[model samples]
Target: MLSLFPQILFLAPLALTLLRVVLAIYLAYIAWYLLSRHAEIEHAELPIIGHARHGILWLSAISISAIAALLFIGAWTQVVAIFATVISLKQLVFYKRLKEILPFPPSTCILLLCISLTLIVSGAGGFAFDLPL
Candidate 1:
């Protein structure tokens, strides 16, 4: 697989960007549906702010994803993709749900933190491999 690393390296950031988008979309829908529509009836667990927050989140995500793509293409210098990943992870952490301090349940905070931390670790690995000496 080391032999294919070049090709994979060329492709993986795009894949990561795609992963971020799909994951964000799914999470957004879950947050939105839970807080906006279902809460009145079934006691939705995610925060109401999370739904509205997603629009901004996804926008920032898109711009970051674009930068990641550019970094992948080698159009610019340094590990911009790593920077983008970190920024995205930080955004997730920023919006993490906390029922007492925030209006959202603790579960959402846990879930988002886990996801963001996983992404951060994954991004760190990618950066170590991707960066130039």
Candidate 2:
């Protein structure tokens, strides 16, 4: 079998690193948006939930901010990625109702979900705190 550009294969881990950083940034942005504009979000019924509560939104924002920080540093990456995947899945499932509260659109949610799944299967890639056990 003939191969081309095999030398660049060593850098594959960096690609995962990049995905992690981007996903972290996106989560951070969502948290920030929720925190900054919580007051403006009108009361509405969220999917699976009868009605959205202000306190719940506040708690979610704070928790997401923490998750974003953990993800940015690549600490407990697989665990954090699992959380991210669940959040993204929720966003995708409730896009219609959540669109008003969330900053990004449904497409971005799908992308984030994909990234989270990758990190979960790949184990945080390079420059991460999660070492193989």
Candidate 3:
């Protein structure tokens, strides 16, 4: 088992990324639930930092896009992973602030969490691209 540890560590992020996708699907379903139940998710939400949530969402999109570009360029995975983790922390802040202002459904919370996690994992691409392709 100890010998398997290294292999497990190597594969961990990819597996985690796949799990994140599954969790995101579940969370999206919950978002759908909130909509169906006529909860706050259905209403217009409050502003964040004197601006709309769309700004945070845009930042999230850009963050993910940056991670993707780094992966495509075969950059250092650990370095990128660090950046992704930092961005995930920011995402957590956004989620917390959004929840305080608008009370998003549990599913939406899960989805955001999953997305942040997946980005962090995906950003660690094969210990920073082993193939040199």
Candidate 4:
């Protein structure tokens, strides 16, 4: 089973970049979903920081999408990685139970946290748009 997994050290940068892009899309989707289901979602006691207010959700979605775009283009890699790390940390701090969905379990949040940290340390690598086109 272990053989099926890629060598973490050898593929660290690519894995981190992929994880960052995946997380950005996931965060954007969650924001849009929360905004759409504000009444139902906010019925539970939510942290003020994680409130499902329209403005908050919209800003979250936009920011997450921007991060995703930056990650995709491999531009401002460190900055976007830091921003993602902050947002993920905020989610862990303020909204441990941000979702009740099946596919998006708590472990997913933890994985995102790890991914952000990896990107912050390893960076986007040679394939990044940071190089001349």
TM-score of each: 0.33, 0.87, 0.37, 0.67
In model 4, residue pairs whose N, Cα or C atoms come closer than 3 Å (at least 3 residues apart or on different chains), thus clashing, are none
Query: What tens digits encode model 2's per-residue C-alpha lDDT throughout 1-133?
Result: 4559877888989998899899999999988887787666636555566564778778888899888998888899999999999989988987886677778788989999999999898877888887742
Report lDDT (CA) for all predictions: 0.44, 0.85, 0.47, 0.67
Error of 2 at 115 (Å): 0.4
What is candidate 3's TM-score against the reference?
A: 0.37
Which should have the higher lDDT, number 1 or number 3?
Answer: 3
Worst 10 residues of 4 by lDDT: 94-103
lDDT of 4 by residue, 1-133 (tens): 4656566568755765676577667766665665666666655556665545667656766777778778777788777878877876766665546555212555676787787777677777656876422
Clashing pairs in 3: 77-128
Model 2, poorest ten-residue lDDT window?
41-50
Candidate with best lDDT: 2
**Compared with the true structure, what per-residue lDDT tens digits does model 3 show for residues 1-133?**
5774675677765664454444334434433433443433334353445433544445544555655455444455435545544543443556644554334554554555555555454553333343321
lDDT of 1 by residue, 1-133 (tens): 5674575577665554444444454444443433443334233234444333445545544664555455434333234434544544544564544222232354554554454444445542233334342
User: What overall lDDT, based on C-alpha atoms, would model 1 receive against the true structure?
Assistant: 0.44
- Leading candidate by TM-score: 2
Q: What TM-score does structure 4 among the candidates reach? A: 0.67
On the 0 to 100 scale, the lDDT of residue 21 in model 2 is 92
